[model samples]
Target: MDKRPSVLVIGDLMLDRYITGTASRLSPEAPVPVILYQSNEDRPGGAANVALNLVAMGCDVTLVGVIGEDAEGELLLSLLLSPHIDTSNIEADSQRPTTSKTRIMAGAHQVARVDREIASDVWEHHAHTFLRLVRKMLRPESIGGHPFDAVVFSDYAKGVVTEDLVRKAVENARFCGEDGIPVIVDPKRKDFRAYKGATLITPNVAEIQLATGKSVGSNEEASTVAQDVAERYECSVLLTRSEKGMLLCDKENGLKTMLITSRPVSVSDVSGAGDTVVAAVAAGLARGLDLEAACRHAEVAAEIAVSKPGTSIVTEAEIIKREAAA
Candidate 1:
């Protein structure tokens, strides 16, 4: 029997394109510098990046999201089709363009970014289809009586994570029994109510303030806010504070809060760091780690992710090496 944990990632999917060049001179018409065309590369972004992170950590991952029937979408799918990842649930819609972020990089620094996407909620039929897919994936008989261990909602506020979708997913997970699978959400919406009933939520300091209108500047403040949010939502909350580390408040097993301090490392690009955190945490939970231990694993994963340039992922071997070094 294959006992490896399986994770289902659902939400916005995008492609990140990087155009690297040298900007030695300014433009003639405007003040912007002229980027000497050098090289360009594309990688999976958004929810797809989360799936990648999970796969790199040795988890069986299934990615579910909406993409357009366009070239960019094809490219994104191609990049995501890996031996450990199942993309059978990713659907294509012709009415919308695939979400993409094109960054113009001058050497190692990003000068500007161009985004092409539709911010509106997915069509009703699409949402219905997505819900059906989720139900099927959660059904034990769907995969020879082996169900997913965890479900992650990687919301980028990019239209795929609707309120209905979140609610339905939670309900379906609860219906499966076995104490119900853990539903984790990396929320971006201003309204925290949309993510209610999730087993856990990973929100950064800025997101907490934006969603709850409470500024968390100190460790004490972060603890208070995390507790308040967890109580309000009746779920655990992992509040990520850059540099200060992460504060986790688990409501499921008493209102206990643990602050995992961040490691001191030379920071590079922080792009996709949140995705890495959520992915690591979800993989840990799926593998039967408690919330605090899972969060500590995430902290380490995030440290490794930010040390590299651009959106990056850490493999299980990298994590082991870091652990041995520590």
Candidate 2:
């Protein structure tokens, strides 16, 4: 923990804008309640949020992804370009606007959400720039070692994460050492195979069901499904079950899978909780912690994340404070 672990984050990056206020009147044109706009706050979202989470964990972070040639993109950069984070690899796409999600909150309740993005494959728009940067990061220098201690593939199913990218990143990353650094993936794509060779993949109940068409109604069933998927994909599985906590069926542990139960708390919102888990786990690994230890710590971090509203951040100090209190 003395040194900051360098982490590379590659995936779809975006901005999250929150509009919080009180709503008392119904809209004259529609039946929905009208929300009188109060104040708006913008934060890094998607993969950008992952970078933020890592930086909060005291990691030296580098972000690589596509952004729009727009004001929103500029705002995102301003928020994320910090002393702890390197944003040099992030590229801009003129054809598409920056991906942004605007959420309207009526006090504690979410009234509505508006998203601005092009959901298609963005390879045509940013492949050349992305591939070049990725390869550069992956390439080994003859000096000390690889720049990163961990690599995170935060796939939002946007055009950024590709099958080719995954393979190449892992392939070139082996130069870090004989064992190579841990490759952690926060997968959103239905087909789990695209994230093959990752050290671990964090998926929730719905993602599990969609990827393998299996029922996760029970703990035993969920474990079986997770083990199968992990085996099929040739990586470990860290299954995040909202209230039930998380299940870790790691390939590194053979047939052993540990399910860490969630601590009882008031759940606010589940959005971006998985990102916290990914960041915590990757940070733990970068700091020389094993996957099991990483996941246990990540569970604590995620529990903290869900207790707060919106795509908020969880820091190492906060997590340490929480553990001390516990």
Candidate 3:
């Protein structure tokens, strides 16, 4: 890890379109929900948000993901380009549409929402193209020929993070082990099998419970599952327990778990907090921070993320201010 180390973000890219309005009156046309009557905002989401957070934190970031050539895709690219993050790794697929999650908010409350996206597995040809794009982005010429200090896998489980890509990346990271590049995964799947060799996997309480088939009624249960995952997957884990905080377990460190509490905050929206967490951890580790230090940094970043509205992007200054106060 080095100061100002570069990071690479891979997985799904999506647009979070928020339609905010007051819902005082119910819609007669639709029996299901009330209609919103105010303007809205759009933001980057999924893997794109992870890159945005990294860029906002002043880390040189490269985003590799698939998006359609549709309007949403255009918006996603435009948003990424406006920031300091690099979009050279973004690949367009004509066959699929760019994923978008639209939330209709009535003032501070969510009224109704709809998701316009696809969840099919990546076709073989497109997978190959994405692999090529990844290889290109990792090349020195494209990204300064320097190896990324950390690789963040922000999996929304929407299909961009294919098995082939995961295998290739893990193998590459293992080969560069002494260089000490940490590969972090923000996993969505119930099974941690696919992300076997990742340096760190961040899964929420529910995800951990489902993945490990262990009931998580208490911290004791969570601790047990954390160690179970670490030993079974042969990797470290940072289990996020929402209000209960997080637990870090490393196989090398045995079954002992380290608990880190999150900074209390008035949560406005938790849409992209996971992305922020993954970004902060990756950035911290890449900058040579210890695992505990990195998890704390991520927790602070997540607190900032939750305080903002919608799929908000946490800035470096905000994180620094929170850190100072903490």
Candidate 4:
């Protein structure tokens, strides 16, 4: 064993269903497209995928979030139990429906997709209950009586990660940080403000544009946006620009910055790249790495994830081998 550290992942837990077939003709019954074949199934997604990546990287992971008491939720629970993950913090709700996204693909290309979820604002009562649960999970006596090395907020803008919930998570991490725990966030739009005290925040190009209201046209532009966000939120920021690579900025450390380009790889799909980045960052923090080193590891892990098909994960050994080859 490499003495991997324990990590806590919290946010949306979803099921991703992919329909793969051949689209050889148009529909005769309506003015629309048609598929000539059929194949489909479900896979872990959102924060679940993040946790999966953490486990693949030899980290002990515990996922804390909500899931519906439906068949999909049952399947997800079963899958997690099969792994070494500690799911004692996962809450199943009969009132809310499980979040699921279905993507239709023809060969390696995605054609269309549908999302079945509830995005309306969560009730205050539910938010209070969720926060209480989270605090309990982070207490000194929970989860083998040892505090987690880090916590990750893998928000997908779903209702599960409400503003109040995010704020509570930050406060909890602040308390943990006094004792040397790190908090990393993979944030979405509405709750970005809720992650003010995070140790690190990872947002993609489009998300950075939306969050910072800046058009990143060049390297300097990327640095400026990162600096703005880091200054505003009082935390380090990492901007992942798909093919263009990534940029990191930390205001406390003389506002240092580093840009990492994507390694050469066979392109197949871009799904779950953000999840992989957050996963790698969480793993790195747990293993006693600084924000820059964690972002570098995450960049390489995301490159590996994008090269594979459909919300795939990257292993630690695979990242080491790829970096060595590079």
Q: What is the TM-score of each candidate against the true structure?
A: 0.96, 0.96, 0.93, 0.93
lDDT of 2 by residue, 126-235 (tens): 77667776677766666445788999999998789988888888777767666788899999988998888888999989998999999998999999999898889889
> How does model 3 score by TM-score?
0.93
Quality of model 2 by C-alpha lDDT = 0.89
Write down the lDDT of every candidate, Cα atoms only. Answer: 0.90, 0.89, 0.82, 0.82
Q: How large is the C-alpha RMSD of every model relative to the true structure?
A: 1.8, 1.5, 2.7, 2.3
Model 1: CA > 4 A from native = 140-146
lDDT per residue for candidate 1 within 1-326, as digits (tens), equals 65678899999999999999999999999999999999999989999999999999989898999999999999999999788899988989999999999999999899999999998998888899988887676664434443688999999998899888888888878756466788999999997898888999999998999998988998888888899999898889999888998999999768788889888988888999999999999999898898888999999998999999899988878887887788
* Model 1 clash number: 0
What is the C-alpha lDDT profile of model 3 across 120-239, one tens digit per residue? 777787688877765654443333454588888988888888767876777666545455468899998867899998889999877887787788668788788788889888889998
lDDT of 4 by residue, 170-256 (tens): 676655544647778888874367778778899988888887778887999999878878887888988899888899897669778
Better structure of 1 and 2 per lDDT: 1
lDDT of 4 at 18: 91
